[model samples]
Target chain A: MNQIDIGKWSQRDLNMLRTSSDTREIDLLTTSVRDLNATLQAFGSNTRSDEASFRVLTPNGAHAIAVGIDAPLNVEIAGHVGYYCGGMNKCASIIIDGNAGQGVGENMMSGVIHVKGDASQCAGATAHGGLLLIEGNASARCGISMKGIDIVVKGGIGHLSGFMGQTGRLVAFGDAGEALGDSIYEARIYVRGKVESLGADCIEKELRDEHRAELFALLKQADEAHKADVSEFRRYGSARKLYNFHIDNAGAY
Target chain B: MCGIAGLFIKRTRLQPRLGELLASMTSTLCSRGPDSAGFALYTAGEPGRAKLTLTSVEERADFEALGEMLSRAVSAPVSVVGRYTHAVVTVPADLVNLCRNWLLENAQDVRILSEGGHLEIYKEVGYPDDIARSFGIASLGGTHGIAHTRMATESAVTATGAHPFSTGPDQCLVHNGSLSNHASVRRELGRDGIVPQTENDTEVAAGYLTRELKRGRSLGEALKSSVEDLDGFFTFVVGTKNGFGVLRDPIACKPAVMAETDDYVAFASEYRSLTPLPGIKSAKLFEPKPATPYFWEH
Candidate 1:
């Protein structure tokens, strides 16, 4: 058996391996990002039943690290990443050990992206499906236009979070900045701490048993089931007042 | 979009590497603003001496004879250190105004970039890396620095329109967003005898801070009030003789990421610019909150 040192393997060498169950390590310092994404993208077309795991080292705040992955492969990024780290992700679990720049998991179809450190503005904007778990705080305008995605933030979220969401679930364990869920629709928000102010067309709603069950499941998925209680959280959703062209509510428009 | 980067050294041992670290940081932001680049560096100053940074297109014809003429006018030894298209003239602290007035009346070709005891500003219409290399920024030593790369939104891409705009002694400001009410604010400032050097909006903001500081307001107070007075989207990084400050507008659409360690506090438009710094992996990184003023002084 020939044991290949994964660290010494070049981009050409990595390209030769069609499918493998072994974990591959790709150092971004030595390998180009184009090659890394190309390899990950190739897994989407593979017919193999085995799963592949990849470990990316020294991300160094590079943009578009592992975008457009369509397989159930697990990818772990070691350091900080720039804009759109795991954008348009599908069926893959991407973990970022360090901070992430703007739009960490934008427009993902399915799967999970876990950011261990803080995330910049718009953490999970316009995503149709999947989960984005942020251990640290997320800055302004998180989940601006979501179709269907589950987001669990362990820390605080900045202003205008969950704005104009058509359908989704956003859970924040810490305090929320001003104007939470402005002009929102259908998407539910559960915040445990203080909400600075609710946005236009968004209002606090009673948390029922089903909502509690949903929140509990999300908290468990984020590994904070024991740290936070479902009953302690308050639910917010659209008031549905501005849904139509009402003459009385012209000021809101 | 524009890019802003700043570094304030907390540990005395790291002060000597300020320029080298800032140069690397600024180089990473070349894509954000490639039209022009500028930087302001603060060094230790003598008690009775002041420095004026000047730039001219005709460096040889304008700078060579101006130093001797200014020295004779001020009756003090004024030494000029000339680099590519820029020079720093040191004069007696009390005679700085006289020297400035003489230069304004006598030297029509030379333009003053900054005037202060410890501050020296260098800026040009070029790529950030090229500008940093031309000024030898990597070899210079300083206590703190602020740099800007401009994309030229509101004004022409001239050297004077480039950022790190200095309106007062030892004070400079770099902005990453556009101001909506600069024309009104410029007119308002004109009533108070505060005139901006360029049509650029960032310079108008710098002039506003200079007026505020001249009125006995601290840097923090000035920044806090700026959020209310300036109507625009902005992430401003301000540098003074002894401090550094960062502030964002209430509607902070522009991006700003800040990192702090035991040795220094750094701010950039994006996280990529900070990757070149030492011990950055262990640094406490966070985005500056909106409508808040954060300041650190020596």
Candidate 2:
């Protein structure tokens, strides 16, 4: 573990680091959240920055660690983080070395957030656009109400994942808990393992060549291209029965 | 936004450090819950004695006199020790309910926290850090323990509303997330004569478990029944005299993580709370699945 004295680095220093093409390290235990957030805000405000990298140590379950960052820098958090670790992220490539609490990449417009360990509930909740990848299992509501994001989970996901999704793709390599993809719309789901139960309006469909290609590409991006066969996945999507007004389905509704 | 933590020592060597480890784990979740904090410690008890924990609205109360009165009424010795706004009363094991009934009829200002041969509960409405320090929990020793920090979603912030709710002898429960069907369940349990002291949904859950256990169901079986009957989002960690358990609701929206090593089995609302545990770096870590109940006995 690299020990860093947070007092040695200032927010101004962080801005300069963003402009410079070098890697930096910051210890969360040694610094206050105000300073760390100030540094992240400064890094976000400046556009057209160099390819800088930051290594954060001892996150220790703090919430909103790298929220609302618009930069394309590489950020790595060394320990477990609390809620909203990469919330509202844009263009940044954030990585968590350990497990993440709730809403790891919630509402991200554009970016890549990778968790090397397990993620809590609502990992990518309500995200519009981004690529969220989890190497380990994710708890409930993994991609609820997703608009345009593409999520890839290598392990099992808990209940209520991909609920009310408007548009996007969710690919899971392991089992799904109860009520997966409830009341979904447009978004497609691909699961390689057992699905405990399907949600309302969600039905399994045949895997076509186009879906296989897409899954393969997603796996390559998530760095798991050679791990499994893409043809093993089953597809799930909305049945479109709930989209129109029908008096026959009134009692069901 | 509540925090729940539990520690069960599997190795005999780590038994003495249970309180120190649990205090650190519970204190890590201070930011998650700032309204109240409480813990239930399972210490060594005398063969024929039970401990009754009580909390008053204020720090000043006639706990000594209450103990004397209880001793006289039960025809047994009763000893009292005051800690902050709470007190522990030790009496004969079989007369626990007698003393508890006496308190309920006489001492209206004091609330019974727990009554068991091996369990002692302490709780207060304050910052979690302050409550832990005031109780001097770190220096205490035990075989196992559980704690909670409450954000108070359903009820007001009171010591009675704090978690580690003990509904049965040597049994306690702490919870995260709200129960959507708690109002109906509370009514149902009340009809069964398992009334709860506070309006907190967690207390209702505890009452349900106590009722199930009273009906000759095992801890694991009661938890499994909870998965079928309980509605809403919740991650519950229950502690008994000789066992520990964890259960998540079907939806499982709430967060829960468990870590186990040769030395101990630990649980927390988040993984950060498990960092201070011994050998956690190499411990077997996993998130409990939804609707799956897990139990550990010693």
Candidate 3:
């Protein structure tokens, strides 16, 4: 119902607008996190940050637009987001024009969240539904307790990603964090990257033909530089012991 | 509409704020259904039957009048067992058969959402917290219960659309899936004197399953009948007087998980939902194979 332009507004005025879905149609290029936060607040459920249609725009000097909406909003944040960007979405579709921050797309359900940017730590720590795409790098705790969501980080993730997942899929582009899928329950993790270290109960498994096909489909759709070849990556999953509670695997840490 | 959560406190006395846990699950899922909420809990030898929610009457007085008529029509004594936006009736065990008959006849106007021994429900157009406060579902202390979190993509977000719908006496079902053959199935079931309360395929499945179970078929057989007979991608969890049950269409398009241990058991469309159940950290969780029906008999 309102349009508060960040480009013209003073810095003090920017913080007042916490979230958005208005006038997201107008492209005001600035890289300040305060302005971008205003942009996140202005754009509500119907629009996107930088949705499906791609364009090259580098907004310099931005930190974060954390706590995005819970609707079908999309975004292509040029360059990278600092931290916790695109968090808590419902039916939005966002693709980072560049790399992303740590904990990207946290607690999102029912949308497609992509990060062409290298993600920081704990990417997708506790998401519900939707597909998360990380093109370059991803930090630790990716897809932890991820319920019905799928994450494909093209690069590598930090330690302790996916510590306690319920139901969903986590696909890594390169390598994964340590203690991945520890105490996991019902969620599936697929990685095309190397296994620097396995989580508590995580183990490398065969990348079946079905997995190859799925990776191919995602790569073809996601705008990553390595869209063509996914043969180098391997798959990791639970040993099925974590499916049930065990005294031997007592330490979920 | 709103959220619903039921837990049967078996091993020991229920937590003092057991209702709070259910309220949390329902309220957390408030975005799914934001209209109304209700809950019921029955203890041993209460001799009280629960009427799960089915529909929102155009007029409350008219719905009450219908309740009276249904009691006489089915030769049972019916009462507004649980008050909410929808219908939740409680009858004596002797009158359950008559109540079922009444529910069948009145299915056109209302749905017998869920009627059983342990739990009762009806919800719409709100979050779970509002419903729990109004219906006092948080207070029900039973051995087990089932709740619904709805998005209403396929079904209208109405009281009739509230979940834990009835399929048979002492049987209520919660589902998360789309039924492609809803119209055809409705037509087929209509020929057999079963009237569904809504256009939602979930209610139709409930009606069909109710008919099958009342006709002396076991729940497993009735559920197995659904694999091929029920079309489309779906996964459902049905709760009855005897135990907990899980079912899916020929393909398990919807997500579901079951966790069991010597002390307790839990299942949800997503694994995170199970976190609130008692003894969760100590539980063992497993996913059901596609189209396979899993049952935990008490």
Candidate 4:
């Protein structure tokens, strides 16, 4: 497949290319959300095509861009995106040039999503496995109900983040908001700054050598290992004592 | 789910473009809400007069005659202007309640959308863009405005059921989540004489704010108090005569993003609705904290 130069193509040319089944490498600028979604849907269904890559221009905070991508490909969105970008992603590497709205990389199985700016609430909610990187802050519930996904936020995270988190690792380089990690499970959380309050069943733990090593490796994967020293971060997880029913803790429940 | 957009212009130069900018912001959230849409625009109003925006199934039912009847009853001159299925009635400020009561008795089918010195609300059952176009929103100018596109959860889809529900003079609210204890709260507000028009949780929430503000509580204070009384997941963007405010529940399960520039302060249910604003790429962006009322006034 030849490299397609999106800089020279008009919006109409991009639209025509999206409709053509033979085009493997496409560059799209100024396309409507419906058309772009249609092109991505085609890519998800067409298994016979060779490796395909796409470059999106002027996203203008459109929602649901690059969703349901199951193929192993590359896509770059040049501007900010709205909710559910890279949702249900699989075997892809998606990059965003600007801030993201809610649920970016939501419910993903396997992928690498890079956000150049901050992310809204539930940034990587309910994802199974992937690497979600945010260069800036993430709002409330950043990793709510995650199954197994590694997330790294270079800035602060908001309240109730990592709520009911079952598994995976969440690393924050800045302060965490109130009620962080409410009702959390086996997920490991590493924070570099102060926590306003801890939620029920979530308690601070010692950052042992093993935890430090895991956080260091995760930060390296996010390409932000040098931002903060792994030893400076604190670890948090479930208390585990609440998992079993006890008569003495019935009042607390 | 519902979508909300708000624009507060700090610069007078941008006031003329408020509706156009607001329309674009509201239209970007079409995917969030395709059931119905509405907006409350704040513009200049004559002193000593109050405006009431009402929607009627019958658009051409001689609103002028109804206005004459209201004028005679209130001992003031009243004028009504019809736009599409909505009518704006201007009357003496002291007689606004009398006009509302008279409408309840005389025009049972007509519902007051908003009553304020500067607010004129337009709402309908349709997509956000189509509702904006049908109401000529692009041509309307304002100092600030708020729009809502709703996917109904608690109530049926109707013009009156749409959001930007105004319960007090120059006050409107748009919500993006459902209330868990609305029935009980509705009963509580009913005892306080703040009867809502519908069973929709948002209306109950609006009535709660109005009741608080009527008790002399400030907008920020009312929203702050909502955290304790209003139980549910919610992201609320409220507009007053001279202010714009945003609040989220303690949990903040819903999504809300805000951006501020020298010219304007914008709020959207998601960042996509706010991206089209001027100087947005360089604007100061932040998510409002849970259980905190962030407000800015002119």
Candidate 5:
């Protein structure tokens, strides 16, 4: 067990280590996930003024890589990851150089997760706060049940994206698949390409100047502002029809 | 939840490593399903010859002297190779139906796992790694293969309930999700003279595909129709004599990832299953879309 004893390090020593720009490389082929996560968790418990960069190699679709971090850190994973990569992340910037499996940033509290390749279903499902950027396509339920997260996809999104979204912003530069924003709440959706269909209680809304500003900010935060034009995007949100039960809408229920 | 792994070798040079690659692929999914595992391999066979994979609970009572009895009944040179509780029997292609009928009448205790020219199916109630090792799967050679690890969602944890259910000659199907309308579909197929051997829903799906192919529908057509007729969350990987097909339901909650390279095409319930394949680092990976059928033929 290559465990780090954070308790033994004095505050002065921790401050000195935090000020130094140290880059650590952890190879998944040689190190077990338990050790890697323990080391990262140790860093999470210790506050640092400078960003510590950790490069993880050969993830090979392993689940729960770099999850539950609570401090500022920069993680670069060189290969594909399985379920829940960077899940519950906070104050960290995690970049996946390859594709990611289901729920890439699920339930993340705050931070940024950038997936260079495609992502599987439920990319940012139920996330509360985070900026999830997918450079490639995202499969079904890209932001399903999202609360406060902001997701930006450079490519297309599959069906049922933002389904039952409570509060969030989902932006896609490419086409949106079937049933976009089905039964959505206060969440806002922006699509530059074709929307195959809208789901129950989800309808297109006016993209006012305020929305344009918000979209611009999100795009800039995702480092994709230059790739898309704000004028080309359209917005969708809840119609609030299914918010209450009624006899006329019993079939939908 | 269950796990499914499939490999189709496009390059002939890579055929010899099919079983080896598939073994490594399926082994990674042991955690997803730990109850039972099975695989169907499409190997090269001699012309005018067919093979049947048979299994019995009591191997000594059912498999011993089976070759001599089958040889006398078929009036041909029959070879039976027994491995653990399963046996592979080879006979003349023209005598396949006769052999099947003879076994049905005489060998009541033996169960047929597969019957085809090039396909051989093996399954048992155990871990995927144990099943693969016991069958010596890594040493076998084939052009394509599909494997499954079962968690026994809708059926008992018996060897017969395992996946890679074969219903047609040189055809097999593996499923990762449970089917809701299997009972009704079973009744419908029964009316067409296609009966499933077990109460397993996946076997019924395999029976449905067999019926469609018997009606002259292509593999792609059969899979496309399954999307409409079958009700439930499912991701199916089916293989024929020279083709491989994949299909997911409309509300595809089940996981399915696919990878393709210049050498081979692979499918799995998760990308982790494919990471062990050669050149997987550079393979084109993507999730199969919902309600869509993707097919490849050699």
Candidate 6:
């Protein structure tokens, strides 16, 4: 892996990583580090090059994709990660600055992860824990999961999403797509946006003042735009039937 | 690490409930610096004299002793201003420095937050309301005043690290921003014989601006001088016995919002932080022109 060309990494970091190639990974991520995978291939790590790693790039221009290095690593893609990147952030943090790709923070998780950017889906399709932060908009099927992974989309999530979520939290700052949490298991879906419709036993509950306060508090910390009066949004979650796999709730999504 | 809020009553009609108004503002800023909070307020009766409120005094060993020491130096009757772990002392028109020195030297780490006309200084380690109530600022009354709350970042979240620092007579300043060029400015101020008593960047700002204001410069001119002298981003909400001024640095690294109604005006880090009103009007937001000196007339 050390012999492979890491040139395919983002242009933002090409200059930085080009300057130093042998620093320890632990030191690189002390504050805000860039996740430039291709650059890692050139450095000779005492550990295997195939392992997960995260580094923050200076972000001079907009030209980097597939920012995640590999699995068993969580990369918090800090700034703006450009395009189809983070498609395979299995077991790592792939948080972005603002928005992210068609498939972000996708797949496996013995380790948890995050994506600060708005994902483009299919995000978190398989197992996971840790969390993801989409400070903006998510395009589609944010969490087509089958296992335990907490996917928090602080923005609006797209259609057919959480289609078969087995479990965990699916937080959305905005609306959920049609047939959300469909045939979904114990997964908890909290949305500040209006749902087009419910999938299966998924039901909408009134967002009380306390709930509004809670959501507002979260949005405030994330620096997301939220009206002081958060009564504008609704809440969605499991109807409990999904926990037992009732015949009526089967494929209800 | 401290959060300070002030209420400057424009119309004398709003004068009677000045203390209550200041208490509300201090309480609103509780989250910013929960450690301790205080209010330094002044009414028209006691003109030119600063009445400081030292709130939530967990330690009593130096409280009265410090107050007595300040009174002898200020040459004015520095009475025990309030209660609730807080004390209030008065600085005569010419003895502000002597009073400040006594407060600094006599106490372990004293924060002189807002020593304008009848300075009402209050502080605690966590929770602004607790400090305000403890100091009894909720009942103290005046037209112009300042307060502080803090989230410890650069300096220890102690009474000394609070805002509304005294720069001159009936003149004080509150700051929000990190001074990137603190070392350079400190050296410059030191060269001019102005000594800062704390490690906080704001103290350096207060010290530098205070020196300029003492040299017969107007508040506006002094702030302008600070703009030329200080480096890095900042938005300052300065208070005086007469009124308050809002100034910002060129970069505007931090967020500050100001809104004015026919009756009252408000300034805060976030737009929503201000008390929401009935109208759909938008706030007039301005980031200080980097390195430009700006201030408002009372």
Per-candidate Cα lDDT values, in order, are 0.88, 0.85, 0.60, 0.84, 0.89, 0.56
Q: What TM-score, computed on C-alpha atoms, does each candidate reach?
A: 0.95, 0.90, 0.51, 0.88, 0.95, 0.48
What is the lDDT, from 0 to 100, of the residue A99 in candidate 6?
Answer: 43
Once fitted onto the true fold, the runs of candidate 1 whose alpha carbons sit more than 4 angstroms away are: A1-21, A45-50, B57-62
Candidate 3: where are CA atoms >4 Å away?
A1-253, B1-12, B15-19, B35-56, B61-82, B86-92, B96-112, B116-119, B214-217, B249-251
lDDT of 3 by residue, B240-271 (tens): 77667778664344545556766556665443
Measured against the true chain A, the candidates' chain A TM-scores are: 0.89, 0.88, 0.69, 0.83, 0.90, 0.58
| Candidates, DockQ | 0.65, 0.50, 0.03, 0.59, 0.71, 0.02
Q: What is the lDDT of candidate 6?
A: 0.56
Return the interface RMSD of the candidates, in order shown, one decimal each: 0.8, 1.4, 14.4, 1.4, 0.5, 16.5
Clashing pairs in 2: none
Model 4 docking category: medium
Docking class of 5: medium
Error of 5 at A72 (Å): 0.7
Candidate with more favorable, higher DockQ: 3 or 4: 4
Comparing 2 with 5 on TM-score, the higher-scoring candidate is 5
* lDDT (Cα, 0-100) at B280 in candidate 5: 90
lDDT of 2 by residue, B1-298 (tens): 8999999999889888888899999988898899999999998888999999898765556789888988898899999988777889999988888888888888888888898888989898999989988988887778789999999999899888999899999999999998889999999999999999888899999999999999999999999999878888899999999999999887676778889999999999878899898788788888888788999999
RMSD of each: 6.7, 6.5, 15.8, 7.0, 5.7, 21.0
Residue range A141-218, candidate 1, lDDT tens digits:
988887777888999999999999888789999999999999998888999999999999999999999888878877
Q: Which run of 10 residues does model 6 chain B get worst, by summed lDDT?
A: B278-287
lDDT of 1 at B252: 80
Of the pair 2 and 6, which is ahead by DockQ?
2
Ranking by lDDT: 5, 1, 2, 4, 3, 6
| TM of chain B, each | 0.98, 0.97, 0.78, 0.96, 0.98, 0.77
lDDT of 2 by residue, A142-172 (tens): 8999887788899988788999888878889
Return the candidate ranking by TM-score, descending.
Answer: 5, 1, 2, 4, 3, 6
lDDT tens per residue, model 3, A72-184:
44445554444566777655556566555456778876566667555655677788666677766665567767766677776676566677777766777666645667767
Residue pairs clashing in model 5 are: none
